[model samples]
Target: MIAAVNDETNLVEKERKIDAIRWNQAEELSTFDYFDINALLAYLVKVNIVARWTRLDDKQGREMLHRLMTSLDGKDLINKQ
Candidate 1:
């Protein structure tokens, strides 16, 4: 799966594919945990993964970091679509 992602020539598509893979992995890891802190942690991981790709065009890491930090304070950053 990662090999296929790496083979993608389009940079944006490659990134999106990789993010999808990461999201799937997170979901799989959290599948067994129901309503526990692991579920919450998984949710946060998924959010961060979404944020990473959603803001792919932004070259400034500092701005992205700031937005992620703000999201951590009980605010939904990007809708978990």
Candidate 2:
């Protein structure tokens, strides 16, 4: 009765929160992922995420990040595909 109603309310609120999170992630990518290292770092800190990199040429940097990210099974990068 009352408990059942409360459960449904909680579930709906949880769903709304999840949707908001997905929206925020998409927005962040559009805003930051195409930029320089400092922009990426700022976005990461703001979103409470993490990243790692090495001193390499642009091509090497892309290859290394792509390799590491794929090895992570799409864990924590912009292109999580």
Candidate 3:
């Protein structure tokens, strides 16, 4: 139905917006001279990833962003476990 198609289109658009925001945030984070944990946390919160941002250190932040990017691209690394 037309209504179902419209709903699906809206959902896809929302997902694209979220992905764009996430990638932009990741790119911005990569540009920092010295990591600002608060700024990174704020961006994650804006992208609805607050829970994942808790207690993150610099290494963890970098790893998380990498994983997010890989996942978005359908190319995540395999876990040994």
Candidate 4:
């Protein structure tokens, strides 16, 4: 997984690879603990991963990048959160 992520040249693809690795790890960790708190937490983690990808917007990302680049010349940097 590390090699796959490292081999990915596009930034978005690299991010996707990382997310996939995270999801798989979470799934593996929860595989033997059905109906337990850990399983519930892992389900939440998977849900969050899905939600994150669903909310991804290329236009918003580019706009945020532009804002960040513009702020680099200023005293304070732009904060996304």
Candidate 5:
């Protein structure tokens, strides 16, 4: 499981790098800057999606997911309490 997760993560990283390159190329060709807030938000969304999809059976991934959920729950509890 760890191996599989590692492989998936590596692949995702590669894809991200490729995507970045493509984005840069497109921006260059179109004479546009790729540093806008909307672009950043879109990049973050893409990263999260990739992380979730490539998590596989990784213990670290599970832990991260748990931590994120816990943090959100804590925020909800504080808001409601």
Candidate 6:
């Protein structure tokens, strides 16, 4: 009985926080660099494929993904040359 009431209260609190965040629209309007995001996603997918067929540990995979993302500079990231 108490647990249910507590859960409902928590839910309402979370909903109120979300509502406040929605009203605070100034912070949410910034654009993301989708091209870099996509490139990072592609590299992650390739890593996953290779991992499925071989031994790629979590730590090494994360490090490699981080390195790949940081290496994506604006200079011909998509082979624009």
Residues forming the 10-long window of minimal summed lDDT in candidate 4? 72-81
lDDT of 1 by residue, 1-81 (tens): 999988899997887677667767766787667578877887787678756755765554345456445644543424542
Cα lDDT tens digits for candidate 5, 17-80:
5544544444345333245765455445544643654465366455545644563354654676
> Which candidate gets the maximum TM-score versus the true structure?
4
Better of 3 and 4 by lDDT: 4
Return the TM-score for each candidate structure.
Answer: 0.60, 0.29, 0.30, 0.63, 0.30, 0.27
lDDT of each: 0.67, 0.44, 0.49, 0.66, 0.49, 0.44
Predicted structure 5: lDDT: 0.49
Cα RMSD of predicted structure 3: 11.4
* Candidate 3 TM-score over all chains jointly: 0.30
Candidate 5 root-mean-square deviation in Å: 11.9
Model 6, span 1-81: residue lDDT tens: 333344655664554344334323322332233446644555455455335323434664465456445544545546664
lDDT by residue (tens digit), candidate 4, 1-81? 698689889997888778778777876897667579977887777666666665796564555445434533434323432
Which residue runs of candidate 3 sit more than 4 Å off their true CA positions? 1-9, 32-81
In model 4, pairs of residues that clash are: none
Over 4 Å off, model 5: 1-9, 32-81
Taking the tens digit of each residue's C-alpha lDDT, what string does model 2 give over 1-81?
Answer: 333344555664554344345435544555534567755654444333212223323554455456435533534554653
Clashing pairs in 3: none
lDDT of 3 by residue, 1-81 (tens): 333344555664554455456656665665432247755664565345423442334554456566555643522323422
lDDT of 5 at 72: 33
Give candidate 1 misplaced runs (Cα > 4 Å). 57-81
Query: Which ten-residue region of model 2 has the weakest summed lDDT?
Result: 47-56
